[model samples]
Target chain A: MGLVPRVVVDVMPKPEILDPQGKAVLGALPRLGFSGVTEVRQGKRFELQVEGEVTEAVLADVHRMAEMLLSNPVIENFEVRVEETA
Target chain B: MGLVPRVVVDVMPKPEILDPQGKAVLGALPRLGFSGVTEVRQGKRFELQVEGEVTEAVLADVHRMAEMLLSNPVIENFEVRVEETA
Candidate 1:
């Protein structure tokens, strides 16, 4: 069997969507003396240990998975990065 | 003034921490026809639009911010990547 690959998927809320979490962080930054942080958007990241190789087909499958499970298609956008960790 | 830099920070739960969200995704994958996904770890990503250049000092500042506010240092780890967007 081929070595399993590691995948990192980042899911972010759409620019127009309201992100309370992000806003909360932005609010807290200045208190921590992290000034000049104009804006912040909080999102989700999924790190997957897959039972297969990193291939175009596998990436497509993962993308589908992201669209179907990892993110809300209407309000979120996701990016998939595949790595051959094994 | 230097161009604003976009910084991406990824925060992940410690390997041993129990991640209910990750478990939820793993469970839902198969039902969505995405089999062979042995494991999944759910985490958070922060996209920051900073009013500064992407420099080492800026990265270090972001790292400090991550430790102080972006993550639970006791059970989470974070990485910061900076990119020039202007």
Candidate 2:
């Protein structure tokens, strides 16, 4: 089977921003008997399957998508990268 | 500044499962004038900061944590990896 190129965009909350969801997870870990984890921050991961070769233009478009829709620039930072191709 | 070891855990919905959030993003992309992206999948990324060195035992514990707390094995798949260390 032919797989299309895939791009991954990760959106994480800004360091100074409060991550309530991550805090909840952190609170639950030790209760579940898991230790050594001192902090937890949760974010979103997006996998985009594109129709053609992943060129510079494609990556630039992906970056635009990340900034415009996948993440909120005011509260989050996003990273875009080509994950795989076929 | 001293940086601690960090482990990343990614939890994605099983391919066969319907992802309404991803669907919403896919539908919005074209309306925003971004094309060529045929599909989109949204998932969760977790960054865990550990208290000390990331050893084999730490990784094993993280794997167990991923299986038990980070993902729903019945409908989601999870990956755990050590991202960076200090």
Candidate 3:
């Protein structure tokens, strides 16, 4: 591990929302000779390197960050967690 | 678990490459009152629903998909794994 710990935030579209990018990929799959994939959902992943240790307070702040900027609550859901460093 | 299994593919830019999007997010963070984050790297996460059981062969195919379409091998690296369903 480096001197700083890392936090991972994943922002994904809501299940009800349509993901055109994913649909495009799904359509292109079979054309590329890849099959058996029924659905594909594309999302964003963010890795943040924190200056200090990952405490509950920092995690809470990260959650708030996810809600306020990383994701649009109306159409997306966000998950925040600590990513173990190698 | 549902009738089908889900595979997760994460595509991230190589560490040596410049990530302008992530840099933009990092620049906007402090303006949004988010601090303590030294660095940020943004990537893509893909959730793929497979029609049948997720075997090693399926995983291999997913890896190939990641290499051929999901990511640009010249600048990005991808990881493919089965996502456990609830």
Model 2, B1-86: lDDT tens digits are: 67656899999999999999999999999999999998999999999988778899998998988898889999999988887546
TM of chain B vs. native, candidate 1: 0.85
Q: Candidate 3: which pairs clash?
A: none
Candidate 1 regions with alpha-carbon error over 4 angstroms: A1-4, B1-4, B84-86
Interface RMSD of 3: 0.6
Clashes of 1: 0
| Candidate 3 or 1, higher TM-score | 3
Error of 2 at B75 (Å): 0.7
TM-score per candidate, chains pooled: 0.90, 0.93, 0.95
**Cα lDDT tens digits for candidate 1, A1-86:** 45556899999999999999999999999888888788999999999987646778878889999988899999999999976655
Give the count of colliding residue pairs in each prediction.
0, 0, 0
lDDT of each: 0.88, 0.91, 0.90
**Candidate 2 positional error at A52, Å:** 0.7
User: How does residue A52 of candidate 3 score in lDDT?
Assistant: 71
User: Candidate 2 regions off by >4 Å?
Assistant: A1-4, B1-3
Q: Candidate 2 - CAPRI tier?
A: high
